[model samples]
Target: MNFTDNLAIQLKAAGFSATTDQLSQFTTYYEMLIETNKYLNLTAITDPHEVAVKHFVDSLTALDDKDLIFKEGAKLLDLGTGAGFPGIPLAIMRPDLEIVLSDSL
Candidate 1:
């Protein structure tokens, strides 16, 4: 099985359903992250499996209670969203959740 399939399995096992398009986007984003990290200090998780297990899986954990209290057309502001953490993932998981990621230099 390929990375996408493996990712699908992981997400499903975690009780999340991601469409093919969403998974594709996740794959692309993950690949771009790894490539960009070659020149920048983006993530400390270097290994591919580790990045998936630690970064990706960990993000999914926060979604446990999101659906319970999430309001329609809710606005979310992420301060100091360096490298796009919970904000980015939240945006992906909940497309309806408007997000503004802020970073200061």
Candidate 2:
């Protein structure tokens, strides 16, 4: 299976059911991240499976609660969201949230 399939499996294993569009977005994000990292040194963990588990799945782990920590339509700020960590993933998971990603650079 390809990286996308691996990502979907990992997400499912973590109890996340990402929509097709969300998966597409994540795939796009992953592609861009890898492409950019070639020049910008975005991340050290570049292996596909590692990125899937360590980055994407790990980001969504915070939402395991049945009652989400943030209220609907809440504005969230991902401080120091380097290369869009939990922020981007959270936004993808909860479209109702208004997330702002920030980084020093």
Candidate 3:
């Protein structure tokens, strides 16, 4: 399976779901990440399954708290988010939330 398929399976295993648009966005995001890594080295984990499990799925794990931490339309700042980790995935999952991603580099 490809990146998107792997990502979908990973998300499902993590008890999460993604819309087609979100999946498309994630696919584009992964493509951009891989392409950018060719020069800037955005991430050390480049393998597709590794990225799906370590990066995307790992970031998305925060969504386990659907009612407590993630208030509707809540604004969040993801400090030290290398390659837009939790922030980007959270933004993709919860469009109602306003998320900001930041890193030292």
What are the Cα lDDT values of the candidates? 0.76, 0.91, 0.89
Candidate 2 per-residue lDDT, tens place, 1-105, comes to: 777899999999999999999998888889988999999988999999999999999999878967768888999899999989999989988899999998999
Query: TM-score per candidate, in order?
Result: 0.84, 0.93, 0.92
Across residues 1-105, which tens digit of lDDT does each residue of candidate 1 receive? 666777777888888888888788778878888888899888888676666666676676766767547686888887887677767767777888898999873
Q: Kindly provide the TM-score of model 2 when superposed on the true structure, using C-alpha atoms.
A: 0.93
Over 4 Å off, model 2: 66-68
Candidate with top TM-score is 2
Clash tally for model 1: 0
Which 10-residue window of candidate 2 scores lowest in summed lDDT?
61-70
Error of 3 at 46 (Å): 0.6
Cα lDDT over the full model 2: 0.91
lDDT of model 2, residue 57:
92
* Cα displacement (Å) at residue 15, model 1: 1.2
